[model samples]
Target: MTDTLLKTPLYQAHVDAGAKMVPFAGYDMPVQYGLGVKKEHLHTRDNAGLFDVSHMGQLRLKGANAAAALEALVPVDIIDLPAGQQRYAFFTNEQGGIMDDLMVANLGDHLFVVVNAACKEQDITHLQANLPEDVTLEVITDRALLALQGPKASSVLSRLAPQVADMVFMQVDNVSLMGVDCIVSRSGYTGEDGYEISVPQDKALELANALTAEDEVEWIGLGARDSLRLECGLCLYGHDLDTETTPVESSLLWGISKVRRQDGARPGGFPGADIIFEQIATKAISKKRVGLIGQTKAPVREGAKLFDADNNEIGVVTSGTAGPNAGKPVSMGYVKPEFAALESEVFAEVRGKMLAMTVSKMPFVPQRYYRG
Candidate 1:
């Protein structure tokens, strides 16, 4: 069965380190290492954890009108984005439903986009169909992506690439790490100070080994990655977000840049702009995404039904886990708009019984991104 699965550049390294391999997004990826998920989760919060994320799709959008052409597809201020900076964005359908969430970095002459692994092919096709003749999309297939995350990420990376120390959150730069040319970004999905390094496929294993060789760094698998992001309140595309979920309904209105809003300079040109703007203005969303904290020891998992005080079904749990760092069961799911308030009591049906949960403010742990 594993013979048919796609392998990343670091697949051998993961196996060498005793990683439990699993199928994710058509790739044979690591779900946990010998250190275990709980220890891996705490290690990332306390030190550094290296993640192999090469399955994600990388694309370079080049052309003089690339920024403008891309802006017409998503509700983000892509035109005004300063060079060497990154922004979070998503593709919206005609109904204002989010197709996928992605990160866009202005690379001066072009835009560097990192999209969800599962949606890459679809995203590439979408861009190809919608973008004008002036813009050319190049799917980067020969590069591997690695994420070094934690409070000590900077120190660990700076040892190999001193220039990375100068970069702040959301900043991107081309630097030579261990003599290898790479694109390094001071950004990551985990709510921690980190660097996402894009290196040549041939040099990926060498770079991964160098980073893991650091005393403060260790191999972290997908299990810990999920828990870390969950504690940080980050959304996982297929689960917490989907094509039918609009940004407003997902409580992701902040991702819609101010300049692209109804009152902003270049207003309402993207797909579903009219519907998204109406929802923003009228505050008429039926359900909204919110953080959930299990009041009991039992973990409330995805697909679990949620209910209100009167036992009325309100929503379903999208993601949940025993947060090693948060020290409890943390989850995020959609609930009726009226029951989305912080401290609001809700019940999650687990194992044929309702488990107590509460609506909580997210980043159940505080975000520690280095903004300076």
Candidate 2:
């Protein structure tokens, strides 16, 4: 009954299915359904799990200057994207800090963008206020998002729509399914070979019902979603990334396009171009966000202190959890570059005791993306 709670289109469905709802990013989203997080996590890894992500924000950019205007906002080379291709980019602030990360899909003549639910409103405002006069931003709230993720996701989806089997990772296409037009993209945050489907608001339920009718597909809630992304080394917005973090320090420099890092000629004229460009030139970052696996039962949560062997606090935990796949307490946080090397030993302060930790290579679980 809180006035601040926003509801996704499948809110009623979740309620009817006995989901335990909680407030997240202003939405009354299901934390876990009748199945617990552990069960849901295993189900998604073995078979197919459907997640209602309609709370995520989708938008379209149109006009002759659409690509150019978008390029100005992020470090990615959006202007160079080919038709029907999708590229991941970041939204930066004036001080070279990342405001949010987004996916930009070049749908032929125009651009389709998907941003996190927590950042949609601000992202839209930023685009509207900063984009060139020739470009126009259109919010696509009339659509719904569904993610079918797992080893069997492709099989289930292909059965529903044959053309989906031909789609490669990060590639998107418009196709008709069950008499409804839908946009399907072979991409997901769970490190599984999956697809994200965008459908008309009215037809969303019908499409979801059809997909769930398959024996391989089960409904998944947000509880397992977090653990899945964590095991995959994907950063969560407010926890691991924020307006205070930059793409470079966050190990997201790959998202920065080479053309954007050219000599005096910056690719785009967005905020903090100078600082971002300078970092590209120096290649010397002050701190780095890296992954760590510890040998202790005490779970390190966000804001936990990261200390060197001598107990000197070096950084803080951005995100931490008991990785279901890793079967251990794995975490990510920012640390001084010197202590961020692979195999470097460190400690996480749990209460008053220091738990042993080491800087390890991330993606504790291997990614199963089908690029070919």
Candidate 3:
């Protein structure tokens, strides 16, 4: 059983700081510190909060054919990505179904990849067998990830690393903060202005301590991270998306570049291209991932069934929560496209009670990303 429980470099620090640890994505991580989930969730929205995301997978893929080699596995037009820019993409199966969502950065000579914590090991193995022998897949397991997010995040980080304040969304730059060399990205899972910093594992604690030293900074845990991402309408890998779901049905067509969709005839040779391509041409997609606002206090959770007013089952809830930001229940799930309109009435079977809900626009709370 110990093999199932993974630990990040900050495991000891989490325990030392009195974090309420729990098993998540195979790692024993802090679900919440002494403040609990609600307080931590609000804290991140109102002020800058630090999150130890070391459990995420960081990899460096290097070789002459790196760009072309990776293009064969993912749908994004990686060759088009210029240096110092990053984009969100996914590892797809032959059926065009998503294996996992990932962020890829073209570092000029190589590709920098960050995948979900739960899918890291499998992702590494998949890349190893698929890429050309000349290309090397190097795992940066000795590094740690920290996300500093909120309106004041830039201000807090600027105090130590003044250059970060100028970074636009999705841009990456390598800089030093308080003498520690780091790669900072103006990106985050939550729809808020934030930075995801990659630092040496040994230096993680010191950096975290330094960031938290400011009056506006506090340590946040996974509990708040989940709620914040949900409020932002971001999908959680295992929950909102899965291997069985395709990008088209998941409302992620934007990830497929127009060049690949039109000029290339075939965007990528990754899994599921045929079906995905056919869907793009024929609009065979029957369902869509949409947001829901429940009228009752009961929080609809994963596995809840959805039905129409006549009580006809239409689809299943993939992810849901009583939104911390909305102060009411907000959820996301796939429903038949015919029933996915903004005002369509739907019911989520909550604890045997069919609660009323309406199909609503996402980002239940407006996104606060600093696009400029």
Candidate 4:
């Protein structure tokens, strides 16, 4: 995976903006613009910020049984997904672990899927290996993905594509922006009201320039993107989640519809369904992912062990950051279910010292999605 560094269609655009380039998932990506991470993170919360996420993989799955085939991989009810609707899903391993988390959209004629850049190749392979012969997978490498996020995101985007102004959260549709055909989705990762646009690679720079030129939209980079998602209590792939983690253990049970669990419409169709469904009914999972707020300013990073009040090693921090909006250091980690109660006193082992932390609720900042 590290053999060659890949560049997105907007590579030159990022350099032109004076972005600090770094290697991410084998791609040369912008870590931060001159605005810096803190300001960019706050701007995306108060105003609008544009992100070049073209490094992620987009694919089209088609055929009469595409939904059914996709359901076999993830726990979500893709077959029940309405046209122009998007659903968050994860590819589960046979042993009940997650292969990767992804977003899937029912585009009527086909399924539009976006997977993490790090796991794209393996995700495609897994899908192809399990899907029926009739199902088809098409890698949409000709497109660039962009995310415009913040409270004012919609107002700015509406100026260029007013039709999307009516689109509610998790909705997707083909639209024209700057006279270029693109797929626009009413969703984002920053826990803010926003949209993700999939534009043709050839027009990537043109669209990036047009959007960033807007007063409300400033160019954001990977650094702000990470801190933003972290503050939102969202998981970053390869950090908060991995092949060793299961949806149940990660407290993602809400994503697994009841119809697929206990005595419902279609129970147990996907991989590890028995184990997952059993955990749902019995609540037997050992560890649960929880939010932690550092009682001090010292932020804990990944790999920091967590300890119970009794000084017993209980868990480890998976993702952490100085929560800009929360005005404190916040983190996400997995702990034994017994110690996961809200407000439970725990200690994070940071540099040989036990720092006080409390088990807090996620979305450290309240989510502001425009569901309507």
Candidate 5:
């Protein structure tokens, strides 16, 4: 039952804004407002949309050995990450399977990390259990996060925090917004120019009110967030990624650092690095993730079986949606390596009938991140 679900710091604010609340990730979240998912999705693509992402786990790891301790868990080059910059990374199991994908930013004295909401508890336990006694984990439960995204996001944010105007994509630092200290990161999951603001819970409403008061900013909900991320080919933790899948199979090998993967560098020390590096060199994986476009109007749903021309079961759909911007049904799933090639024709069995589709490239819509 959703009765026992938790509420974020913005729970009352969402209700006051007339949000359609639903249970998600053990929290009551807004699925949409009166604008509907399509308009909300487009609004974020064309203008700035404020999102309540306080449910995501925020943490800080500190100590002289923190960076080295973290590098032992993730495959990214954490030791080389410059202060005020963030790197994308994921936790791996001993078998090279993904435990969770996350963002890590170097804040000089400590490392700031953000993990998936559903995986937060276990992630914290995993990190604490794995790190040495010298390293300490501090959970920031008093902080709430807001994501402002789209083409006009920069202009809207600059009005309140002008120093952030100079911040480029993937950069992060503490900035004052309306006199409230906030950790503003120039990054988002929507594949657009945006900022993720972390503010004290007591001061969160003030920050949210100020940003949404702008003509360019409006409240967006989780339904649009999912579709937006899907359109960008960003994977959802439980669906596109799982404990049984490796980074190479999920098309996330790009997130692995060159220094960690190649020889002569601090290489292959993280869990499952042997299998992952072997897959990187040999390409022996049987299946891989690829994008798909529906030739028909039917929107393909998840778990629908994918088949070859001979009707042999090849793979399963992981994520799908009617892309509002692309004006076509876009989806992502795994298929055999031979069928993973772009433009390769395949059939998706939807409602017991085979529908034709092609292996298409991702980010079905173009990304507009403001990287300097």
Candidate 6:
């Protein structure tokens, strides 16, 4: 690690656990630990895995008009977002392209926003420049974020704070865990029942230690994190999504709330609303994101050019991985509209060999979020 790389609150803990550190988003983060990536990935699927995600940006938006002010920047319905609930959203440009995806939680008195680590400064600037003067944007730098995920996540966390057991997916609350006041949310990047806890910087290591001490929980690193999210069919901001890719093209139309659509009650007030609405109305998108499952054992990786049976280049893979739980190589990529249909056969060029891939539905592994 270099002097310029920043370290999260759990840096020492990761180092002590024999984590192989690497630079990510300007932070010295752990890529894997003593367990290695494959085992860590399997452990999380079978039991529980604790991850240090404190490097991501967290901000608070305060004011009565905070929700309305925020609605103008994204295509989601912020005004109707219920208290103690969170929604997935993204920043869009005038061309209807996604800038960055984020999580917006309605925390009653204010809104708590968590953005991608790499786009922190840019997202902050975007919010500052567009939000009205009444909406106060407060950057949260004194907290550390931790994600405890897996089938046993709820049981492990509920042991510390029993009240969290009642919170379902997308629910957020301020709770006390081991005497530390923390923001707890029933959400995670992995398609598993999990809780994302934001603790004070000073208490982060303690909380992490307590979680890992559980028999079911082990410290996971960035390598497993990426594979987990990839298996979940989640988009990595700069990879699966980018400024030139609109939400429509990224297969993220579900993220746009119905109320913000052209025919909804309040519509067309957001940036690129016209373009998005037109795309929805006309279905004129040239390309779209689709899931690819490899027919052979070879892993089809990102940036691999996809082709049709006619040997014409159709698209490029945006994210790919060998899904441990799915027992196959899975990937997601953009393809011409005609090649984006389910069951459509496509080919990915890897090592000068054309690998057979099939367009399939995402979330290769079932999402095990706790709904009740």
What number of clashing residue pairs does each candidate have, in the order they appear?
Answer: 0, 0, 6, 0, 0, 0
* Model 1 misplaced stretches (Cα beyond 4 Å): none
Please provide, for model 2 over 1-372, each residue's C-alpha lDDT reduced to its tens digit, 9 standing for 90 to 100: 646798878888888878899888889988898889988988998898999998899999999989988998898888878887798898999989999999999988789999999999999999988988889899997899999999999999998788888888999988788888888889998888999999998998888888888999889989899888888899999889999877878998778887887542456477888787777678677889999888886667788999998889898888887877788888999999899999998898887889988898989889888898
Query: Candidate 5, which ten residues in sequence have the lowest lDDT sum?
Result: 260-269
The TM-scores of all predictions, comma-separated, are: 0.99, 0.96, 0.96, 0.98, 0.98, 0.99
- Every model's Cα RMSD, please? 0.7, 1.6, 1.5, 1.3, 0.9, 0.8
Off by over 4 Å in 3: 1-4, 263-266
Please write out the lDDT profile of model 3 over residues 1-372, one tens digit for every residue: 545798888888888878988999898999999888888888889998899999999999998888778888888888788998999989889777889999998777788899999999999999999999988999997889999999899999999988899998899978798798888899998788999999998899899888888999888899889888988889999888888889999989898877667457555576788888888788788788999998888888889999999999998888777898898988899999899889999999887899998899988999998888
Residues 1-372 of candidate 5 have per-residue lDDT tens digits of 567999999999999999999999999999999899999999999999999999999999999999899999988999989999999999999999999999999999999999999999999999989999999999999999999999999999999878888999999999998888899999999988999999999999998998889998889999999899999999999999998999999999889898898672889889999999899899999889999999998889789999999999999899999999989999999999989999998899998899998899998999888877
Give the higher-lDDT candidate: 1 or 2: 1
Q: Rate the local accuracy (lDDT) of all candidates.
A: 0.94, 0.87, 0.88, 0.91, 0.93, 0.94
Shift of residue 158 alpha carbon in model 1, Å: 0.4
Give the better candidate number (2 or 5) by TM-score.
5
Clashing pairs for model 6 are none
Off by over 4 Å in 2: 263-268
Q: Give the poorly placed runs of model 5, Cα more than 4 Å off.
A: none
- Candidate 5 Cα deviation (angstroms), residue 279: 1.1
Deviation (Å) of 67 in candidate 4: 0.5
Cα error, residue 146 of model 2, in Å, equals 0.8
Output the lDDT of residue 257, model 3. 74
Better of 2 and 5 by lDDT: 5
